[model samples]
Target: MKPHIVMISPALANANNGNWQTASRWANFLRQRHAVTILPSNDPETWSSIDKPDLLVALHARRSAAAMEALRERYPDVPSIVVLTGTDLYRDIHVDTSAQLNLQHAGRLVVLQEAGLQELAPAWREKACVIHQSAPSLKPIGAACKSRMPRFEVCMIGHLRAEKDPATFMQAAALLTSPGIRLTHIGGALDAELAAMAEATAAAHSHYRWLGSLAHDDVLHHLRRCHLMVLTSRMEGGANVIIEALMCGVPVLASNISGNRGMLGEDYEGYFAVGDSAALAQAIARAAADSVFYKRLAEQCQARAFLFTPEREEAAVQQLVDNMLNSKSTNRNPFP
Candidate 1:
């Protein structure tokens, strides 16, 4: 019999948001072999029963703690894996009790990027595993396709949030003061102050624009058309946007952190200190104006992009689930 894997997440699989996208993509990958179900984290009735799932994959431990706790109580010996998020790794684990508890309950812990291993306590380090997010290779866009671009646009792809730090993009735009250059931001703003700031920035800056919450395809299309992609995150747990940007043949100017550095190799040259708009702006100018430098980024990004492909991610997930089931205690194995 196939093992039943329950994937508990905050949103549905198809959601345009990063967490949803991750859950959705993982489900698609894991479904090839195991029976997978996507359940809302807050679903109450399921918790009332002593249902034993073969494996429980819970994302953002803090966000889904209630369901996780319920599952742990019902299936004390089953493999329960906790996938950490940016906030959980870089922020919440330090202060959030629920997040810390979730870490304690898990038999196996998955970190999307390599740097996450350093964030764990010494005792928990042995159970941690690093899995790089995957993206499918894009059919090469012809050189002539480049001529269709009417402007040299610098694109920032993320919702307006404190962590994403969209204002840094605006500040960089203010510093650019170039006639042919423009900045386009895509994603919904959760914080009202950030939304107002984006509106105000666009109203005052002729070359700056805020494109609020676009559909997945639309955002990808825009990314494919842009000159380069910018990620100004204050902290990140392996952002999917960087992978998406690379697959689209877009150069990246990202914050210098474990997440970005892991995606773009340690030798990658395009990085600026987090929250430093001036330095980010300078990097952008260099990429746009210097052909040699721009080529270097594009070439390196393309080389690293294969690690994020659908084929690779799907294979890795299938293998992982198989290993978990095959390596279980002899008493739990039906044939044994």
Candidate 2:
């Protein structure tokens, strides 16, 4: 019989966030070799109804803490894996007891990016491994194909939350001087104030439009149609949007943070300091106005594209699980 695996996720398909995307994709990948089931972290009652899984995979250290604890209490020998997110790595783990405890209890820890490994404690680093996210490649749509008016379209993907730093994107839009340059924001407003700000920005900037909560395929379609994508997040545990943008052949202008640095190497020319709207605006203008610079950014993103392939991620995940199950000792680290 195939080993049964239970995955806990804080967000579901309805949320349309990075956590749900990771959980959904990983579950699909693991299901090829194992019997996999995904349970929402919010639903504790449902967790108890199912039989104990051979292995437990929980996304988010703090949100899934209760589920991890319950599984540990019921089946102490069942090895658990904790996948840390932006909040867990950059915020929660530093101050939240549950988040820290989850790291201590997990038999294996997974960080989406290499830089994320640095956030882990020295002791916990033994079992930690990096699993970069993946997205299917889409044919790039040139600007001419997207619009006949010779317009340069840029997009920012992520919900309107303080962590995502939508304000920077909005401010950059306001600073843009080129009438031919259009900015599109795709994501629902998670914070009311941010939503109001988005509304106000859209109203003030004729070139900027905020389209709330597009479907996944629609978002990707919109993404591929754009010349560039901007990521202004204050923190990220390896953003799936970056992978999606690269896969769609769209270059990125990202905030200079460890997570973005990990995705686009340290030397990538497209980084602006975190929360620096002026810098972001300048980078955007440069990419739109300078074809040579834009090409370099595209090439750099393509160079890193191999790391985010679905095949590579699936193989890594399968290998990690196989290693964990085959080992007789729980302390044996699965990742080399």
In order of appearance, the predictions have TM-scores of 0.93, 0.96
Which is the leading candidate under TM-score?
A: 2
Per-residue CA lDDT of candidate 2, range 1-336, in tens? 889999999999999999999999999998888999999998889888989788889999999998888878888988888998788888899899988998998888999989998998898898899998999888887655755646789999999999999999999999989668999999998999999999999899889999999999999989988999999999998999999999988999999999999989899999999989998888889988788999999999999999999999999899888887876255665555
Worst lDDT run of 10 residues, candidate 1, spans 327-336
Each model's number of backbone clashes? 5, 0
Local distance difference test scores for all models:
0.81, 0.90
Query: What are the RMSDs of all candidates, in order?
Result: 2.7, 1.6
lDDT (Cα) of model 2? 0.90
What are the clashing pairs of model 2? none
